[model samples]
Each structure stands twice: as structure tokens, then as C-alpha cells.
Target: MGSLRTCSRSACERAAVATLTFVYSDSTAVLGPLATYAEPHCYDLCTSHAERLTVPRGWEVVRLALPTTPQEPHPDDLVALVNAVREAATDRNQDTGPGVRGSKGTLEPPAGAGAGGARRGHLRILREQ
Candidate 1:
């Protein structure tokens, strides 16, 4: 059976309940629901770690508005995320050396893409219009 995701914190085996992502450009940490798919750079944290999470003195954590209870993950969002991961993995395995020609690579997403490059359903911190 597929097991629940474990916390990203080293040496811990507890199932993750939340996800944490860092925006290094702005020195901000964004904590929200468990990601649809775990991106390599994002952190999957267990309840205890998430509750006690901290950052360096100059950094900030922005906790998005989460529902009072755990809810089901959206099917469409999960599918999109899984597809993105598969595409990325496939590209990695293929040789992209200069000797290979006429390969149309996946285009980079335009600005406003969600964190960790998932296409949709993310909690974004937008500036006032």
C-alpha cells in the first residue's frame, strides 16, 4: 500500500499534516495544507514540527488561512500536480545535450505560477491591487 508522506525533517517518521515553502527572495516562509504533490524544494512537516516551526531571526512565516478541519484534497489540482512531476522526471531522464537537435523543450511557466511550479490551487500572497 502507498504510505502517508513522512515529515521532511530528518530522522522523523511521522505522517505530514502541513507543507512549508520558503520564498528566499522575500525572506518569507509560507505554511499551508499538505501540497498536492511534494516538490523537491518544499517541506512536508508533521503536526508537531509545523506547530513548533520557526525561522532565523530575520525571516518571517506567513500562515495562510486554513480551514478549521482537514478537508479532502481537490482531485483536479492533484492531477495537475502529478502530471507536472511526471513531465519533469521525464525531461530529466532524457538527454538534453547539444548533440540532440529539434527537441521542443517544455516552456517555463509565465509569471504568477504557483509555488513549487504547480499550475493551480495554491494559497498566494498577492499585493493589493
Candidate 2:
């Protein structure tokens, strides 16, 4: 989905919460939910602009139900968060083997930590004795 769009009305910089479109044949102005993609003929409006919208003398105004609350996080986003936490936990657990101190006083990964449990990047997880 696209980021929050600003109201199309000039000089009004509020985030758009609704979309407005006109039906020339029916002489009606429709105000509803934000469009998936902005169209040349559709106008994106903020809460104030959408509520105060007016049309020509003979034009009818049709207002569709607007969302009362903010949008929730996408399911994919939640799943990604969970996966990242799991990966971090797994990495920490794999580094639990006692670290060996080299001649240079640098801690080295346990012998079996090679190949499969190879340390990633320059950072290593340290556990208290």
C-alpha cells in the first residue's frame, strides 16, 4: 500500500483520509475511501475537506461510510517481526558453547561452532560465567 497522501486541495497539507470523485452523467459527487491508486480525475481529501465538500447547485452528494479508526498493521509485517525475533533467539542459543580465549586475549568460537554454527558478522553474543 502507498504511504499516507496529502489532501489534493491546494494549500491544505493534511493527510488525506478519503477520495472524492464526480459522476458527470448523474450529476453527483461521491466521497468515499481512499483509492488504491490516484487517478487523474479523482481528488484525495483530508477529514476536514471531505466533510465540508460541496458541489454545484444541482449536483447530489453521496457519502460512503469512512473508517472510524486507524488502519491495523499488515499480517505480513507481524509475521516478519516474529521471524526476526526467532532468528535472533536461535543465533543467541547457538553461541552458548563456552568461548575459548586465544593468545591475543580474543575470544574464539567453540570448535564445533564452525560450519553449521559459524558466527555471523563481527559481533558475538557473550554469556556470563
Best by TM-score: 2
Steric clash pairs (candidate 2):
none
Across residues 43-83, which tens digit of lDDT does each residue of candidate 2 receive? 99988999999899999999999887545559998799867
Clashes of each: 0, 0
Global lDDT of model 1: 0.74
lDDT of 1 by residue, 1-129 (tens): 222798999999987778999999999999998887889999988778998999999999999764455555578977999689768746754757333675434444547755555343363333333
TM-score for candidate 2? 0.56
- RMSD of every candidate to native, in Å, equals 15.4, 11.7
Error of 1 at 123 (Å): 36
Per-model TM-score versus the true fold: 0.51, 0.56
Best by lDDT: 2
Overall local distance difference test of candidate 2 = 0.76
Q: Which stretches of candidate 2 lie over 4 Å from their true place?
A: 1-3, 77-129
